[model samples]
Target: MQKQKTGIRHMFTGTLPQVVASLTGTISAVNDGMHYGWSAPIIPILQSDDTPIRISKTDESWLETMYLIGGIAGLPVTIYLVDKIGRKNSTIVSSCTSLLSWILIALAPNVACLYVARFLSGLAGDMAFVATPMYVAEIADQKIRGLLSSLIYLMMLFGILLIYLIAPFTPFYVPSIVGSLLLITQLASFSFMPKSPYYLLSKNKVDSARKALDRLRTTKNNEAELEDISRAIERQKKEKGRPQDLLLVKSNRKALIVMTVLNAAQHFCGISVMLMNMHSILTEAGSVYLKSTTTAIIFSVCMLTAATFSSFFVDKYGRKFLLITSSSLTGICLLVLAIYFNLKTVGYDVRSVSWIPIACVMAYAAVFKIGLGMVPIVISAELFSNRVKAMGMTIADAMYLIFGLLSIELYKGLSESYGYHVPFYLFSALSLVTTVFTIVIVPETKGKTLEEIQMLLKGEKPVCSNDDDATDNLTQA
Candidate 1:
């Protein structure tokens, strides 16, 4: 008799449907950033009323301040909530914040209300950024965790697409309706989801953590791996409790420097600003063929597709190669756009020039997502030990948001005052600088355990690159 085939299937097959749903929730929740950043494209609707709220330079300035300031305000809450209540609860709260902000913004009586609503939304949006990654990383198995976390960025791009698609048809209320619907769905769906086992384990809920591990593992044969996971969890807790642990003490300030620089390098590439404000940037470069709404939608769709592909390659190609290649390619694309815009100054107004900027924008988005967008998160997880992963990720994200704010603010004014060429050229130069830094400093972490990564960061030569027998604390309970 033929024996029945029996084994645990891949986690992706069991989880892909849920992953897609979670992806939609995340994308919809964060869509507000694109909505506000491209407010210029929706300005005509905002102004059509008799008593109009002019989206002026002053308004944009206030909006920018609100975003950065609000994100700062939200961090303490996010940090406390993510560890305390677990990732699921924090995401629900964040989604509600976005929902409330959009409703108020859509029906605002004045410019002040708009600013306040956007500010609140920014605070909520930041919380999602913090919690979603943690949840994705926690729920996913070791094999596909990077790809799952990368989905956060990928879904954010889709949110951009939704906004761009809706902006043209019904300016102010449509995007708000879309955002609110997404949040309502998320609020409902996330209610049924289980709390993170990591948080439960931290609170001494080992039995619950074990159950969650079982459910998340999706197989009977996972019993052995499940026990290993529980032990690993215990080991991480003990390691974290030790005050003077080598990994906890910031082993090799050089690794800290490497991860930190790489993290900062991601935002400095101008990926967020370019995708968020694509419409205005294209218009600034003298594109007359595409309307702001159409351009914004196209740009958003391109970015989403590019980011989706990036998730597939992230693990296969390894982080370092992608970072170096993606950065250089992004820089080249920006330089071409810069050159085209600069040439326009001397009366070289060719009809084909319009599409050049569009093509360049797509090219830049493709490369940025493939390298800088996905790799930093992967590197952040791999660079430090399990003991430090939580705090290390927090620090990295904080810096990312801080510099991210600066990049957005700088792009807005720099593009408006200096010309379209200025922002793109500056980002291109920064990308080139980061490319060199990545090649020299960042090491490959593919298929290596966290403890082994720590050893590599310490500059200790290993018997084999993938061997981690020397630093097995992570593998113990």
Candidate 2:
């Protein structure tokens, strides 16, 4: 019993550095979450009679969407900075941008100021999403990479939950002030963390790469791992990583397809609509038992909880299983929501079933976080080789922003014209389609090293390297 206990302790002790590093790196995500969730509660306040800034309906829509537009504009800069300045530095740049955005929000004099603030927030978020995952994935041991990589989404959810809890009760500028403090904290702490070993190796800083790897692994014998990374980098360096290479190369093309579909499905499932419009959606449900603010809090809590739960099992159960299960169950929940709204729309008495929308949406939040909410980001970080990773992630992020923009716009247009049921039904059907796509097309990447994942994508059998053996021994030790 004592021996078994020691073994278990050893397992966790070995990965402690990785966990700390991942958490520190993902602080930016927490800030991004706050920025994303800020609009949810603040929008109603802006639109009401007692408003800080006067805004039209068009202004209201722009307030929510300007972030995404900024994200789209920021992608070119992100793609350039991610590879040019290094992942760690890129994240530092993002932190500074976030700080500025929040300050702008707190002191906004007009709707135009609000738009610029949201735009900078989106730009900062886009940069963080691209750089943070790459930093975490490159630093983590393969055994725990999924868990570490998933931290990005988990932190983002926490940020959302943080804003939800704070924003509804506080003054308009308070959340912005809080957000600025969080970014400041992130900037100060994350500045000390080492750069990714992979990035170091790519830049031919072999000694610095070794030092970073040793620091991350907390072990001295990393020569085998260093050689492995060097070999992979050399192979990748042979291929010229132009934007077109994402299509012309077989492995790159496969990676692009998987990430594209996954990102599209992620947004098409109506997550953005739900997050940004939770207060309004719950209010429209007409639940007399709980206020919309209270229900929205519950919604964000459930999402954060489900995401926390998923982090424990993502590696154990594998990506495909969780994704398929999450997508299928999410579709069912959305379908139920569609039915409830349709009943209310067609004059059927929904008084007895007023709780259905709350239940379905709460359930959707939980189920969606389990897989659809988090898996795409995890898998996106895993699929591409170092060669085209920056480009692939750029395209993937662009798709995520574009699809999110489309989903939000469609929801607004459809819900206004045809009723909420229309968009819910559409989201439900697309979710089911995403389920089919995952099973038939997406590759299971659990437990594979970055090289092995690339090999699998290229239709070759993955062969274990000396580094895998060495890393496995370190994990076991």
Candidate 3:
């Protein structure tokens, strides 16, 4: 019996099952990334005679705005679906929505169809975005939680890279069709995946949660770990996280506010538009001589490379160090970009150093990916309890789209009205703010369990398992 118990414990720590679950849960995110990146390459096609649609400049801006607005509009639907149906089912629903959107895009005859297609895709993305981080947090082991959660960003960046790479080589409709089939394949595989143990526990299905955990864990020998999960759920159930919980409770308010600020940081940094506009930005940078498609591929490659390092090293150096350092450097890069563009607009023969803008943007993408890109999402997953996790994510994502909408409009307007540097200055200031907020307010969560994180957010102290200085933080608290 002892040997059998040891065998079970040994099997529990295996990483393969956890990795598979992580990828399965992220199918919607992959599709979302593909859709967002699709816009930049597809825009010029809509203007060309290859398609019947003839979109003006103003219409193009609306096309950009439409996806964000659709995301905001889909929040309530996402919240209701995710909360009512459980994370796994909501994820499946999101994948199907994406599949449909791509089908529409593949067959779109006019601008109106394209508009509706973009909105549907955005709705699907919102659903996936809200569900993925929480699902990852619930299913991943404490040992690899941060890393696995950060993998979501990697998957997203890969999707963008995939589409951008394919677009230049293949016919335009091929990527869309390929994307549709990819969703189909992913959805088919995801159907066999297990549900979140936390979500099962929330429904009082203790035995089922155990089975789900066993399916995911594969290597832990001790019943003690499972028992600890039970105890953690019991503690979290005390605060079921009603919407009023956010307003009435101090701890809840802190979690909500902190998450909102970080999310706003993610948006206001201007990476979203930067990724989408990579092609256009390079073309217009005047001094950067790379072909437009090459620029997009390069940007995606840099981000993907940074994301790999981030996912591997996040737990080693801790989230706080990466966030602070990356954001500060990102700010400096953006400031330089602003100056370069300003000088270029004034005809200062900035071509003497034609590489400045490309170098700045590439550096900015790398630094941002290491910390700001993934840490905010990881933090969001760690902060909320199961009952309120959906609500919390919905609120944070709403803030994301709001600022995203503003940045999209502002980047276009300011670049046209003043200079391209104007928007970078705005982004630089926001990056500075993000860096300071992270340093001042964000708590470290190196190896704490979801429950311990809850206690930390609830003003109780946590002892970190990874860092020797963790006890000092508790005492400081």
| Candidate order, TM-score descending | 2, 3, 1
Q: In model 3, what are the clashing residue pairs, if there are any?
A: 9-219, 9-220, 9-221, 11-218, 11-219, 12-218, 12-219, 12-220, 13-219, 13-220
lDDT of 2 by residue, 1-477 (tens): 997676445435667878887888888898899988877788888888989999998997788789889899999999999999999999999989999999999999999999999999999999999998998889887777878899999999899888888887888999888888888888788888889999999999999998888888767788988898899999999889988899999999999999998898988899988877776786777864777678778888999999988876676677898999999999999999888889889989888878888888889999999999888899888898898898899889999988887889899999999998999999999999999999998988877778888898899987654233444664544
Clashing pairs in 2: none
Candidate 3 runs further than 4 Å off = 1-13, 52-59, 220-222, 276-285, 344-347, 416-418, 468-477
List ranges where model 2 is wrong by over 4 Å.
1-11, 48-50, 279-288, 345-347, 465-477
lDDT of 1 by residue, 165-228 (tens): 6675664677787777777876777677665566666677878877766666545455554555
lDDT of 3 by residue, 128-204 (tens): 88887888888877667888888777888898998888876677679778888778888888888888888887788
- Evaluated at residue 440, the lDDT of candidate 1 is 88
> Whole-model Cα lDDT per candidate?
0.67, 0.87, 0.80
Candidate 1 residue pairs that clash: none
TM-score of 3: 0.90
How many pairs in model 3 have backbone atoms within 3 A of each other, for residues 3 or more apart or on separate chains, i.e. clashes? 10
